[model samples]
Target: MNIIETNLNFGNLTKRSRTVRAILHHSAGSKASAEDIHRWHLANGWAGAGYHFLVRKDGSVYRLRPEWAVGAHASGSNSDSIGICFEGNFMTESMPTAQKQAGKELVAWVKKKYGFTKVQAHRDVQATGCPGTNFPFAEIANGSTGTVTPTPPTSGNTYTVQKGDTLTAIAKKYNTTVDALAKASGITDPNKIHVGQTIVIKGAAEKPKPTKPNGNTGTNPIIRDGQIHARNFAMPGLGADGIRGPRTKEAGIRVLQQAMNRDYGAGLALDGIWGRKSEKALGRHTVRRGEKQYMVTALQILLMLKGYYCNGVDGHFGAGCEKAVRQYQADHGLTVDGIAGYNTFKSLIQ
Candidate 1:
C-alpha cells in the first residue's frame, strides 16, 4: 500500500503552454490538499482538478490540473491559463496560519514557473465573493508587478458581513456598484444575500466567453470525466457518498494517524495530525492498519472520548455510535445518516 497517493501523474501530463496568465484563489469551505482539489475538479466535471496547483492549510502544495490541461476553475478563461485554488474559504474569516504562508509561496512559485504577467483574485475577474474579503489578492497582484516580497491587501479593505450591509453601502466602500457585483455573482436579489456571505468589492475583468445562442453562461461549467464533483468530493480513495462531513474527516484523521504510528514506533499524539506535528510523525509511522474500517474504529474511540460523542466503542458500528453520530452531524450540518461515511468522519475528528 502506498503511504501517500497522487492523482496527477506527470506521465500523462498535458503539453506545456506559454499563455498562462493569472492565478485565482478560491475556498474549499475548509482546508484541503492540491490532490484533494484535483479530485474535486474532476468531480465538478472539470478535466482534472480545476486548479493548476493547491496549497494546504499547512502550506503543503500539490499540482492539480496541469498547466496545459484546460481547467474549469475560472470563468471565460479556461483555454489559456493556470488556475490555483487554496483549500480554505478566506471569506468571512482568516485562513489557518500555515495556509497563509503557503498561499504566498504557491503564488510566487506559479509566477516564477509560468512567467505569468498578472496575478488576479477570482473576484477580480468575476463578480463573486470568492478569494474572500480578507484575502490579500490585490497585494499579491501588485507585489508581483515589481516588489520582491508579497504585500498584504490594504487595511479597512475587508468587510465582515454585518446585520445590514446594503448594496449601496458595499458599493460606496469599494467604489463599485451593487448591480455589477450582483450580476457578477449571479445573484437575483441584493437584499436576499446573507450575513457571513463573502462578496467581491473589486470586480473582475470580463474575458471573452464562448458564444452560442443563449450561450452557455458557463457559471458551473465542468467536464464529465465519469468521476466525482466538488459538491460531492469529501472522500475519493475511500469509496463514499461525496459530501464533506464529520465521517469523512474522522476517517481521514484515522488514516493519517495509522500511517504515522507505523514508522514512528509510538503514536505521540492521537489527534488526526491535521497540522504539522502529525505530518512529521506520519513519516516515522508508515505501517498500514490492515483494513481501512479498522483504522476508522480507532478514530471512533477518540471521537467518543472527546465528549463530542457518547458512542460506545465497538468493532462494528452500533446505534449508540450512530446516535452520537447524528448529534455530531446536526451540530456540524451533516446529512444525519446513521452510517459513518467520509463527510461524517472528517467533521467528527477534525
Candidate 2:
C-alpha cells in the first residue's frame, strides 16, 4: 500500500508505549481529507487529528498523525492501539473496491510490522457503534488481498471518441484548442479521424504527484519531548520546556497523585509512584452531574488526555463533563450512566 506523507502539524502528541492491536474506524462522512479532520480535532481541543491514517475513496492513504504516537481514536485502547479511519460513512454508503482493497493491504502491513493478531472495530472496544454496522471488519482484518501493489490513479489524459464526435467538438469538450489536441494525439489529419479513436487532450488533468514516505520508525526523538509527555499524561499547570527530563514525567505523576489525595482523601505520600496503595485508595467513589470536586477535575483531565473533549479541566461536573464521562464509558465497554465510578476511574487512571 502507498502511504502518503502529510505536512499537517500536530503540536504535541503522546508516544504510545506498545502496539497490541489495530482498531478500524469510519470518518462518519462521505468526503474529507486528513487536513480537514485535523482542523476538526483541533477545534475539539485535541492535539490534532486522532487517527494515525486515513484511507480515501480513491485508494489514497494519507498519514494524519504519526503512526507510532498514541491516538485519540479509541478511548481506553488509545495507548496501545493503532487507528485506521476510512473515508465515508459505511452505515449509509458502500465502500469502493479500491478503498476496501487498500484497507486490507494497510491492515496486513500493520499486522506484519507489529506482530498484531487482534484487529477490532470501534464498536468492539467502545460502547457506541462506529466504523458502522456496514463496515467490512472481517474482510479487511483478514487481509486476504495479499501483497499486490496498489495501482495509483491513472496518468494518461486521453479521451475516447464517440460515433458522432469531431476533432473540433472534442477540443471544445476538453476546453483545449483543436491544434493542441491534434498535436497531443499525433493526428496529422484531425478532420479525418474515425470513430473509436483515442485522442489525448492537451492541458487536461496533470498526473497525480507521487507521495513521499514519512521515514517514521516509531522511535523518532521528537516523540520523546517533554511537551508531548505533559500533554499525554494530562498534567495541567506543568510547564513543558521541550526537554525530555525525568522531572517532567515525575511531575505529571505527582499531579495525578495529588488530585487523588485531594478528592478521595487517600492519605498516601505525595510520591510520584502509582503503586498499589494509590490503586487501592481509588475506592468506589462515584461522581456524576451537578457536582463540583477535585475528582471531577481529575476526571476531565483524564478524559482530555484520552482524546475526549471536556471543555477544560475545571473542577465542575457540569453538562460537558457528564457528556465526556458518558463518551468515555461508552468507548471503554462500561455502563453508560455518565458517572465516574470506581470502574471508570480505574480505566482512566490505570
Residue 218, candidate 2: how far off, in angstroms? 29
**What's the alpha carbon RMSD for model 1?**
20.1
lDDT by residue for model 1 (59-141), tens? 44555654446667668766677777767777766667655655665566456645666777777677788888777675555
All models, RMSD in angstroms: 20.1, 19.6
Error of 2 at 233 (Å): 41
TM-score of each prediction: 0.37, 0.44
Highest lDDT: give the candidate number: 2
lDDT of every predicted structure (CA atoms): 0.49, 0.69
Q: In TM-score terms, which candidate is top?
A: 2
